[model samples]
Target: MAAHEKMPDFDVIIIGAGISGINFAYRMQERNPELTYCILDGRHEIGGTWSLFQYPGIRSDSDLYTFSFAWRPWTGKDCIVHGSIIRQYLEDSAAQEGIDKKIRFRHKVNKLSWSSSPSMWDCDITVNDTEKMSLRSRFIFLGTGYYDYEEPLPADIPGIHKFQGKVVHPQFWPDDLDYADKRVVVIGSGATAITLLPSLATSAAHVTMLQRSPTYIASLPTRGVFEAIVLKILPSSMANRVIRLKWMLFSLFMVSMCHRFPRLAKSFFLRETAKILPPGMSLEPDFVPSYNPWDQRLCLCPNGDFYAAIRSGKASIHTGIIETITASSITLASGKELHPDIIMTATGLKLRLAGGIAITVDGEPYNLSDNFTWRTAMVEGLPNLVLSIGYTNASWTLGTDSTAHLACRLLNRMRKRGLSVIMPRMTAEERKELEERPFLALSATYVKEGGNVFPKTASTAPWQPRSYYWRDLAIARWGRYQERHGVVEIGLVTDLSR
Candidate 1:
């Protein structure tokens, strides 16, 4: 290759040096070491989500066995790994694999445009908050996971700006704020809220959880004997098989727990919760969720921090409509007021697809919403764009690994055929059929209007892989890899009509 003044053009440009990005880059290089690639990350370091969430007691909801990459098994003692450890693992993995040198930290991609003349992409990126640079590549891989951008906290309440203690969003937590000896109010019942309350309660005078509606909560052993057995008796390959089996069985048990005996499931939670509450405190129906189990994500407490806080009388759960916020207090719908020195909004994240990257084909913008039949993260009509959206119900990494493996296969196939672009090409009938059939619709909030878009595959619980892992694995491993659904062929520029 000839040297140029600017950075050499690469065969691929990967956004976000997080786990998915790093892993995908490694796979691409493994397949073809000669293919040049570069990774751009907004943060000064790797680890993506793990690096961003620095709150106390932050841990993985999924077990480490399934949460980690298949290539690198987790040898850590704790099955339910903490955020810091996960961050360290990811960073270490990158360094040990010699993939860290390809990464450009603090380089944030702002815009990407595809050029048909050279069959390449012109990526405009910002680095270190100052420099503006452009890079060209034949392929673009978006490893920017969701959750980086947060939903706007609606401040329509009566007096949000008035006497405010420290108002914090979990996404943008203050580094210097002291929570000890302060009364804290945590708003929202999502995962972040569930994880934060117990940690805050230890130092805060009191922590109150506010929920607008009920959500199902489930608990499992943070560390299990099965993991130990795999490490002791089974070889790595055999251990993976046993781990997969355990995952399936546990998934089934969860399904049954939610369906066959919902009341039993509810009681189980209540009883466990009561054990950690101070005397006279009970798991009241007001605090218990009425929705089906796993309808929303089940809040996890690996070390029983939530119940511990309640048992110590440091935490309380409140369910009601919030009227407004005063300078020093929050008013509920029942005309009651609770004073707090700090307020944390643990609201869910705003979902942005392709990291809000605008993708175009032959200079025409591709609107993903218009083409929604997702097959292994590839839309029906888009070409040369393969996404890694895992099963909504299982571990994120599980599905991501499968997606990366499948992408490797697709890329290999392309290389064998000497093809430039491969686009999904479903017929009108297939499109209509897919449109009519109901889908779980992973991006509900992202939809312009919210309602169930498609019927879930399984009406009964546990049988379905609501998690991205299950769905992606099924599609990648068993679903059609052949160009049957719809595969469009692209020719070189000299042969193009334009």
Candidate 2:
């Protein structure tokens, strides 16, 4: 260490105490026990998405077996469960591993700057939204998922403010809000609306899902007889791995079928969905989406609860474009009107990477979009930084685990080489010749709308966004990442005074 340079407070600073952050912490402890680290979160609690969202009937769209960490088996009875259960699971995992002790809640990182002189990252943070502090670390792990927690995508209704009754956005659902024996209209066809309708219908007088268009709604079995038999036969540890692998393979197969044979997959989905709806109800505008299957994520309706609610005369679906909102009702462009006591906007979320923290390299502002990714985890020209974005097509944690393993491997390689800094670099000429692609794999609306904020991808290896699990697993475990056409460069820093 140079005499003029100050020692970093910790070797690594992980931002966010969510699933990815916890998983990374565990991997670091297991793979590199000598490295010191701490987790910083803006919120007072853990579980980034699970903690923030408190809407009724909030649950994981993906099965728990696949969504959870592979190291820690999910022994829950139901494959799909409520949000509170997930929160408790995360809390338990963190507490058990003693990772919770290293977390500093309410430490919101505002900006990060890479100091070349010290070969470290200087993080500017706001503690408890009042006191400001700065901390330095040799590396930074961004476990903050992509999405704006503070504000949702603006409600696009023309005259929503004119409505006299209560309006709610699921992102910030009020604990005190009541809709018992009252008519409610949820305005969106996405997952939140699908999940909320059944729960709201149980108590509300009438719950109507009003949407401009339809989204693919599919019924999923929470637990089947096959799973029960398997659990009964295999050991607890083996059963967990078996179920997790089964779901992983099944999910991949379903996605591949949808992508390769859209017409056949759409027909199969439509046919299966029609079987669950009430006899008199038609599948025309209510369940038939304009786009093909898997264009957007399929809204999983567990045990056909959403359809069951519709059959019980408590919930209904209305498809049309909203013209305006009146004091007591909403008027549609097709001359239809809906009178509800409460309105809930399940529109969508805005994408914000790394919790919207400003980044600078040697005092110059850093724009993530300008750089390409290395192994879909590290960014080009960014040293000792790792991003924990998950797969859009499958369970998020699977991709997260892959990134964690690859990051640990990179750190071990750095230690072996006696390197202080490592970055994925592309020659100016090579960068100019490379074609740019969208960072996210999904073609969802929000992804396309807010695409520019994320990093770019290319047609070639390493630069491409992480997609295939088996391929990425192999690469993360044993691929020569740095030998990919001179993309990655490592350096050993010398004394600052020299």
Candidate 3:
């Protein structure tokens, strides 16, 4: 009587109700209709990041055309929209597809352990913050995103404790705090900070963006004239597909150009940024970054709104190391001081993998760093598991959908073959020749600071780091799963009687 011999609760258990989770559920149901699956979310609601961050002017850094779920398609007029709108769209998407019913909200998965006897995964979950329960499933899909939702990247300011005024972190913004006509200082030059500047500038007497180093900011339109014309002429479904493809190609092209011609891309970015800045504002101290283009993600300023705030004389940009923070002011290394009524730390996210779920195999702990990712979806040496992580270079949903479809395809193969277990393994010879690399290609602070939270990447196929969406999508659809020196194997199925 082994632990896994008993019938599992479900065929699959997805670990988050966020964008990746919802997308996985849809793909699983579509491709494998007979398979039973449930989504477990730690939060009470559906939207993950969108529901979590409620700061003013929070929006998607990528265009909604590609960022939105592929099946539902974003019908909004604006390509870049507010966080609330994205949440509403996700809610509607889940409800319309009946996926919302499959979610078990507030059921936090604490740990997952794979039992080899019957080849099922045992899940330890906490329901409603009080009751503890255990469940079993044949497969576990980790839709848990790559960031620590509970804790953001710590603010590294020297004297943050001494600040008397209202201090806030964008990850945990207070809803009731009003900053009307009050001086505000936003820390960091990332997308969140850029998005917050123009928004806070509208109501605040003054807003200053405080960054230790300059980051490249690129202006993008909320709605393009070409897209508008295409929407007007084409049918709704056709128009949605057209716009999505357009943005997909554009995003890929931009990233490729930046990588292939770094000098040209840097020049173009600098030229465009200078045009939008206030007259006489040089690019040296505030706009120029020491790194090459696409080394880190470029901060997107929708419609030049952040620049508009600066031109209005309500917002300013200051780049210098923080010396100290007193009761009401932040002193810079260059002796300049900024007095702010509200200090918003839009610093960055704390990167984490599988939402910090402790994983085990055969009663032994499984460390993620020890394994290599198989096609950026499945991990080597882990059985019946897949991690759905989005791309940093392109739209997050594209990578998620690719992984989802690939998982479904693998599941279909296993079911048709009467196989109960699927595991990614590597030969000893192959392991020796494999070159391990960082999971993410970006040199962003958060990615570097994450410190091996993600699994390692290799230099070869199905193990190489995830990059462009088109190539990954192709691999997901038609790549050889059994080849590649037998990287993935469909293990024995003894539970056919069930």
Q: Which prediction has the highest lDDT against the true structure?
A: 3
Q: List the residue pairs that clash in candidate 2.
A: none
**lDDT tens readout by residue for model 3, 151-266:** 98997889999999999999998889999999999999898999999999999999999998989888999989988999899998998999999999999999999999999999
**TM-score of candidate 2 against the unseen true structure:** 0.97
Ranking by lDDT: 3, 2, 1
The 10-residue segment with the lowest total lDDT in model 2: 489-498
lDDT (CA) per prediction: 0.68, 0.88, 0.89
What's the lDDT for candidate 3?
0.89
lDDT of 2: 0.88
User: For residues 240-272, could you state the per-residue lDDT of candidate 1 as single tens digits?
Assistant: 767766875676577557667877777777777
Badly placed stretches (over 4 Å) of model 1 are 1-8, 32-34, 150-158, 233-241, 252-280, 427-430, 436-471, 477-484, 492-498
Which 10-residue window in model 3 sums to the lowest lDDT? 489-498
RMSD of 2: 2.2
